[model samples]
Target: MATSVSVAGFHKPLYSTTFHGGWGTSICGDNSTVLIKSVPEAVRVVKPVRFLPVMKNINEGKGLFAPVVVLARNIIGKKRFNQLRGKAIALHSQVITEFCKSIGADAKQRQGLIRLAKKNGERLGFLA
Candidate 1:
């Protein structure tokens, strides 16, 4: 007797019982059977994949233009560099908010878009 298991688009007997009470043999597609211990009423659970977004600033001195950032950091110093980056990001966000208002988008929609931008930007190694 064979025990059937359906997965994906493949419908076939996953394992066959040769005798009583010890083991079951699973048939591979290439016509090979491997012995697997049989258990009653087994439930299989697969873990879902989770994605983590990485947040990194370009000015932290990494990438093709690392040298440029290093030089800028050296010249402008840490405090001023942070100030410029903060100002630029704030200006960009303001521009987005203004554009959204101009388009007659509601506050809820605008907030959602802003949050999405932050998430996507963080994933893409930009300012969040």
Candidate 2:
């Protein structure tokens, strides 16, 4: 079961009269308020879970099999991390084993690739 749940939405704020005739004067602007339900209330809404290979790659490297790293890398502001978006899936354990078998990367080289991918995510603020 998921641990955290929340529902948030934006609503316009109410305004009181101090109305001025000029277009320059009004009580309301672009202001909005966010409403969030309590955790239990939010949990009542069942959300679908998605499983993606990219998420698996990031999660496994970080030790949890969680997939948020893919999304974070896309927004991490580094060209290298951005380049890793869809490309990181090639680093998955299954994929890596296949590639290493094909190219004969030694155990040391295999470990290096794992570290490199994990380090890349951590440096981009995605792993944490």
Candidate 3:
């Protein structure tokens, strides 16, 4: 649903407003009650459960696996997917943390390992 807002004063030729994901604007010639139509609410985006925002690579099956991602999104839905993905990522991070602790590795080593993993992933190509 879209809503219109009334501004009483603003004697300006152009007025504008912005929202996340995009922007909109309005224009008026004189100082009057301006009825600016607000941009409609953005359609809620359903991010895939398996997608990691941290991975900035393009070949992470964004195009090739789009169909599968859509199917999974339809099956698992937004809320459940979020819950599961969050738990899974947390668990993986915890495991990595524990392993680092056991190895007496500092932050630098952990980051280096992460970089090495990225490099290996790129070499593997399918998952990069």
Candidate 4:
């Protein structure tokens, strides 16, 4: 897993005015106020958003493959199963990519492998 850190800052001036004899006097004379706010505290809020997907390991073979089997069983008839079977490998690889991403797999590498799986399925005529 990889952690990405970032920092940001914002600054604004606080101003005030004062009245003097026969005139409005800018007593502060545009005193420059400097606020050096450390951004380390911000990581707590942002870490979850960026790493939400990798919190738990997604066991692809056990978690996802079982559901595919259950769904394959529920199809109405042989014809439907046959049709679904033709698409099974490609669909399996797509789901695996999602599972990999959830379990901290590098996005670019995982996607490239998934594309290869899809292309293989297509070459084998499993996908038209």
- lDDT string for model 3 (1-128, tens) is 34555556433233347432211223432322332323233643357568556846665544444456556656999678667756765675677778899999998887777667555544444232
Task: List ranges where model 4 is wrong by over 4 Å.
Answer: 1-91, 98-104
The digit string of per-residue lDDT tens for model 1 on 34-118 reads 3222223364225777878796464443345556655776799988987987887788788889989899988898888878866
Deviation (Å) of 62 in candidate 4: 33
For candidate 1, what is the lDDT? 0.61
- Residues 19-117, model 2: lDDT tens digits: 333221222332211112323575655788876755433434453323465456556855777567446555475676778889988988887887787
TM-score each candidate: 0.40, 0.29, 0.40, 0.26
Kindly indicate the candidate among 2 and 4 with the higher TM-score. Answer: 2
Q: lDDT: which candidate is best? A: 1
Cα deviation of 51 in candidate 2 (Å)? 38
lDDT of 1 at 61: 38
Which stretches in model 2 have alpha-carbon errors above 4 Å?
Answer: 1-91
Q: What TM-score does candidate 3 reach? A: 0.40
Q: Locate the minimum summed-lDDT window of 10 residues in model 2.
A: 27-36
Q: How far is candidate 1 from the true structure (C-alpha RMSD, Å)?
A: 13.9
Least accurate stretch of 10 residues (summed lDDT) in model 1?
Answer: 31-40
Which ranges of candidate 3 are over 4 A from the true structure?
Answer: 1-57, 62-70, 114-128
